[model samples]
Target: MIESTFPILEVADMQRALAFYRDALGGVVVYSYPPDGEGEPVYVSLSTGATSMGIGLTESPLPPGNVMLWFYVDDVDRVTTHLTGHGANVIEGPVDQPWGERTALITDPFGTRLHLAAAISAPPDEE
Candidate 1:
């Protein structure tokens, strides 16, 4: 049985990636393994409430715009604005969906796609 799953993203620059995840997404770096000398971190684990994500340094070409990281936020518009201010490209809008959710799509500086959504209020039942 799978208890939980952690997604690991390979990045070329760890520092830049950290800024995006920590600052933009409001994630905390729970653990990190920096290089032996004065250099960027090779691996880092970020925790956002119950979810955890891993970031690793890679020299090979990274698969940009591949995986999508979906986040359920209290306010989709607010979070999308915050991310855009922090250099995240807005791929789509904060539009209301037929399924009763407001969603927004964005891509971080490291080319990681982020999908932010918030549940819409249910309409009152007609008497």
Candidate 2:
């Protein structure tokens, strides 16, 4: 079961992405994969008013064509199984990630990337 959905943008640079989204666009960083450390984050979740998006660092920008949809689900395995049974292409995972999600990468019949994830950790309490 899916709880919510958001868009994720792939970027070549994490710092630049943060500057654009957080500084320029006035978005709030709701969550980041590394939480806090010396290095740059690999992924960040930002809330721009009512809408939110995910910024993910990639080795390089992918050739533009399609958008990715991030689905927050109740069960990663069950959702993955249902999608694959209907012919979705499984690229990786239903694996536990360092950021506390069990996730899977799949492309639907029309080649739209779907990121399915289930949280493995409780979210930090809101301020």
Candidate 3:
């Protein structure tokens, strides 16, 4: 059986990715490899509450507009606006969905897509 999962995203620029994830998404950097080193960070671990994510620097070109990171937030409009103001490009609306969610699609400066959502109604309890 699986215990837990941590998603790692490869980024071309560590500083930009770190700023986006930490400053915009409110993620706290919990651990970073080569801490206080002279060069750019090779790996970084961040968390918001119980959810954790990792960012790693890569020499290869980053595949932008491919993967979407979904975040469930309290206020989709406010969060989307804040992110867009900080350089995220709005791709879709914060419109109400048939499944009962208000969502918005955005792309970061590096081309990573993000989906921000807020529940319009209580989600169905799991079986």
Candidate 4:
């Protein structure tokens, strides 16, 4: 039975990752191994709305994984701009997709690909 699923990234530095995900992306802290104010954290879970992901400390770098973190924001363009200013590299600016979503692609400071998307407009029923 499928219970729950979430992606966990092994990072060289937990603090730097938290800075990007929690500070820059505005993800709320869901859980931390050391629970803020204790020893350095080896693991952390963060959430942006219903979606959550984990970041764990790694002694050495791991080969890039076949994964892309997807996020739904209220304003793709605005979020893209904000992330770039926070050290994210923009692979593509926000563009409307044929499927009706405005999407942008960027990589975090640690080279984690983030797919930022938003609805181009309200659904037909709402309009």
Tens-place lDDT per residue, model 1, 7-124, is 9999898778888888778899888787346566899899987899999899875778469999989899999998888879999989998778899999988778999998996744
Tell me the tens digit of each residue's lDDT in model 3 across 1-127: 9999887889888888877889988999898987866666789999866699899888987676457788988899999989887789999968998778999998887888889998998766668
List clash counts for every candidate, in order. 0, 0, 0, 0
Measured by lDDT, the strongest candidate is 4
Cα-based TM-score, every candidate: 0.85, 0.49, 0.86, 0.91
Model 2, runs deviating above 4 Å: 68-127
- Global Cα lDDT for candidate 2: 0.75
**lDDT score for candidate 4 against the true structure:** 0.89
After TM-score superposition, the amount by which residue 23's alpha carbon in candidate 3 deviates from its true location, in angstroms, is 0.7
- Higher-ranked by TM-score: 1 or 4: 4
Full-model lDDT, candidate 1:
0.86
Q: State the lDDT of candidate 2 residue by residue for 7-78, as single tens digits.
A: 778777778667645764356999998877856799999996667988888886666457876767678888
For candidate 4, report its TM-score. Answer: 0.91
Model 4 Cα lDDT, one tens digit per residue, 28-121 = 9889998878999999988888888999999997766787999999999999999888889999989998778999999988888999999986
Model 4 ranges with Cα > 4 A deviation: 122-127
Query: How accurate locally, in lDDT, is each candidate?
Result: 0.86, 0.75, 0.85, 0.89
Task: Output the worst ten-in-a-row residue range by lDDT, candidate 2.
Answer: 17-26
What is the TM-score (0 to 1) of candidate 1? 0.85
